[model samples]
Target chain A: MSIARFSPFELLLLKSRSQVDTATLLLLAWVLVHRQHVSEGQRRRRLAQVTAQFRHGHELGPIMSIAHSQDLQAIQLAAEVVRKECSNERSLSALYQAITLATDDGDLSLANHYILRFLADLLNIAPSTLSTLFQELTGKPLCPPEDPSRDAYWQQHDPEYHARQAQEAQAAEQQAKEAHARAEQRQRAQTEKQQKKQQKQQQEQQRQQEATRNAKARAQREQAQREHDQHEQARRTRWQQEQARQEEARRRQQHQRSSSPPPADRTTRALAVLGLAPGASRTDVRQAYRRMAQLHHPDRFYSESDHLVALASARFQRIKNAYDYLMQTY
Target chain B: MRDLYQRLALSPSANSHQISSAVTHCANSALRQDAETVLGVAEHRDAYNKLHKTVSDIGQLRARLGLTHGAHWQGDVANDFSLPPDNAISRHDELVDRVSYAVSLYNHWRRFKGPLLLVALFTAGAGIGLAFGFTLGLGLGTR
Candidate 1:
């Protein structure tokens, strides 16, 4: 960067020629544009020198403008070349500007048989989306130079356009909030109504059940009262029949006793059959009966018929009942 | 370390049901690990002891053959992989370092016995010399 030790060739290139030719400038531009090995700082410094003519706008104006012009043929050529060959962001931007300027010249039609010119119109889309479309069409990214919305463009359109967008966004947010609140309130109201309706239905069902229960209890009580009345009536008839039967049985017994004569032998000698002497002690009579019962007990013979067994068992029961009754009466 | 926890069916939660489910998931994942790769870790651990015992038996059988310390007595028979405190990778490095250092020391001892033989000879010579001097002094003093 110091001037004292400058190379002779640099001094010659800077001062020897009053003006540089286009071919040399083009060569310099080629090297600066296609530089790969140079460091980034050196590259920028070199490219700045190479493009100084375009910035300063001194000479080579006619050829440079012609090479990138607003003429119909020139713009079409630039567009074609850009789609095919322009790789850098700056060249693409230049081509796009050229196409827009040509359209402004009014040679291209609105829907016509000529070149396409919606270069400025494409700005309506998002830059990223535009870049993607360009890549899809061209097979490579066509990055615009320095994000075309620089201070010059943004200063003109930022306030009113962005303000309108912000307003629309705020309105949409408010609308969504109101819609959500309304939906929640509607849901809560519907839930409360359903709950109240369920409560009323349950209360009605409970009341109906209680009434049915009470009616059933009353019916049961009446049925039980009818059953008790019928039982009492039957009991009275049974008691009356028993009283008549008892009186008839007693009269029959009295008639038999009065009509029958006394035994001629006048003896209580049934026990004498079992070897009991006259005036025997009760123990002696009981011993004789036991001996006789043992000899005649149906259980002693497996071959005994059920009728014989029954007769023996009945005789035994009669003797027992007579003994028990006599003992109590005595 | 992660695989170890997953293998052990250990989970990370306070709720018993969720923890149990997570533990099941961990065990299932461990069971499904590419057995060709990870299954050998267990086999290798088991075979390590087998190799140690075999090498020791073989070396003892062939004590003359130069495989003296083929099986080392000092070794970690078990290793539990877990997240290390302070440094995780350092533990692995430390284990490897210990094994390497032990192996080197065993190799050196097995190969070299020069200084040891020399020390033994020197001590034996000194003992003999002391015994001879004491006997000579006793004989001369008595005479």
Candidate 2:
């Protein structure tokens, strides 16, 4: 309860926030701050007074003109002049005409300018302020609101009111032109990117062609070397076979003369014939097999796993079976 | 003829504003009258007064015509001096065709400025008495 706690905005927004818990507090706050100085009823009455004054033509004077010199003799005549000039409908029309002429022509009587500017400014400020505040608070329009004006019809209907609108329109057109230019730039950039993509593809094709040409040269060189190596190896095997036949003949002749085998071979033959190292543990066999398999693992040949697996299994199984037979027999 | 018809057809109600308005208008209209409009408008005391005694001479000439009448019909006679309606000018009608025009006589009388209203009254007596005496031819005066 106490209303002195809520802020001014909170107080003013009470109409929209009535269902909220703080509404009572806000309303009381509003009354506490403004009610003492100006009550709601008093505000309405004052507004009515203002309207009444408006009807009575109690507006500020914009200009003064001297007319009917002999008739207008009073010393305090200026005060009554404006009201009297605007008394009836015809005079009121004349008064408005004078004001319009003054405004259009400018350099009008000082009085006329002041009065018109004042009325226009006041009316403009009041309604616009109220509208902005209400709109901000209510989140909806305050339609059919009071205008209390005579020129609203002109303002609303005259779409092409010959004010300074043309200047703004020209500026807006220029802005549109700039925006269009930016769009064109974006389009140009997109086109450039597409052109660059085509260029990059052409370059990649050129690099691939270069790589193919280099690969063809490397394959030709490698093929020549491989053929040369095969020829050398065949020559060596032929030489060895020839040497073996010669040596066999010479050894037969020597054996007939000496009847003894070559020492190196006899030694190896004796060892193999005796077969002294027959027993071996699984660890020893595995160690010996690992050493041999390491030299022939699939990584050494960079071969496929399927081919490596087949070759490794066949070789290891034969070795294991021979080793196992030797161990069982001995 | 059109003007005459207009005047004849006009009712008094066709006029304007107030009776005083009509009176004021009529007076002001006579005051502003020129020689052109003077030919047809009413003859009043001011018109005669404005003539500067041209009427007295017309009256003296009319005094020779001795046709008199009994009572005053025109207006009050000034100093009881005026002329009768008949004169030597009327006797000329003896050798010519005679035509008595009342409106013409009234116009002539109005044109005279010197006591025209009074003279018209006095002339009626003179014209009637003279006519009776001329009828008797030797009639004596009755006391």
Candidate 3:
């Protein structure tokens, strides 16, 4: 793949064996390519670009200082090391990265082109390949027309440049404020959603509790109804039993009354046996009993046959029984 | 007339003197003793005569009421005047019958209560278990 997709520091680190050597080489190449005198603003801008590409921001300061010193021996050493460490493809990729960095300002100086050619020669790349790679990256010939109008060095000293810088800074501050407001709004929306969820859960719990209470109350009422029905059944049974008992007692009393004879019947029969009327006096009952007794007495029939005497004895016994009954009843 | 008077073949108006002579001349000693017991005491004779009189009066009443045959009387004064088989129950006997009825009812309840209670408890437990299982199933299904 072409190293055009990779940043300058990333390509340098990938091709170099040591991280410190790669950083030094990358910075040294950048400084050498921008060797012409430039404004401090341009220098700081270039340093900012390098620092942004470098993964380790804290270490870039010392590497940038060393590269800015323009020490020829350190430059030569970094170049030699890069040349020895890189293969042909990696050497081409490293050179391509450097070309990309140089064109970031929209232009390359003649001196920067010379330095690139020197780096290509040191890495053993053919001059034709360097021209082709540079053309491919920048869409221009290796040697191009000098255009001072494209150079920003004079504009950096202009009053309008300072005003544009102030405007850009103000716009950046306004964007930061808007971003903070959006984040606060998102946080508020999230908190409100959480509170709504909590309220829904509480309402569901209350509904479940009400259902449970209703079920419990229904069970209690059903139990009470069952108990009441049982009590009613018992009461009905007792009432039925009491009614049966009263019926039996009434039947028994009726039976007794029906079976026993009346007292008046006995008095009339006793008077009849004495040969007296129903309303006869006690004296008349006695006189009739005595008269019947004398006539039917067994002693008066003693001279008769055994049969006759037996007959007389039975007759006399009846008359005697009737008299005794009459005397006591009267 | 009473059986005692019938046994001696005597009239209903026979006196105490004639009753004694009849008893003395009776053929059977047992018959003589019975006749003596019934006729010798005025109170016993009265009770005997009254019993026969009650039977006779009942017969007369039946005739007056135009009830033919006199099925319950039949001139057997001893049987007729005897109490009507004493069918009325005593208090103790009735109490015993009532207690037995109560005991039988209790036994019937006892016979049913154990299985009924077990069925009730089992039904309640099964319902509770089913409800609990259904609730747990719903909860798990929701999850």
lDDT for residue A229 in candidate 2, whole number 0-100:
100
TM-score of predicted structure 1: 0.19
How many clashes show up in model 2? 18
Q: Candidate 1: misplaced stretches above 4 Å?
A: A1-20, A25-174, A218-330, B1-143
Question: Residue A146's C-alpha lDDT in candidate 1?
Answer: 21
Docking class of 2: incorrect
TM-scores for the candidates: 0.19, 0.15, 0.25
Q: Which residue pairs come into collision in candidate 3?
A: A314-B8, A314-B9, A314-B10, A315-B9, A315-B10, A315-B11, A319-B11, A319-B13, A319-B14, A320-B14
Cα lDDT tens digits, model 3, A1-330, are: 111233333333444447544544454445443645566556656656644544433444444555555443334335544555568776776677677766765577543553564456556777678889888988987773221112132234344644765799899999999999999999999999999999999999999977876778777878877998999999999999999999999999999987766577777877776677788888898898888888888888654434466787888887788778767655
How does model 1 do on interface RMSD, in angstroms? 41.7
- Among these predictions, the greatest TM-score belongs to 3
What's the best-to-worst order under lDDT? Answer: 3, 1, 2
**How high is the DockQ of candidate 1?**
0.01
- Winner by TM-score between candidate 3 and candidate 2: 3
lDDT of 2 by residue, A36-120 (tens): 2344454344333322323222211110111112111110122122222333443333333323333222233222222222222
Docking class of 3: incorrect
Q: iRMS value of model 3?
A: 79.6
CAPRI quality level assigned to candidate 1 from its DockQ score: incorrect
Alpha-carbon shift of residue A82 in model 2 (angstroms) = 15
Q: lDDT (0-100) at residue A86 of candidate 2? A: 31
Worst-scoring 10-residue span by lDDT in model 1 chain A: A109-118
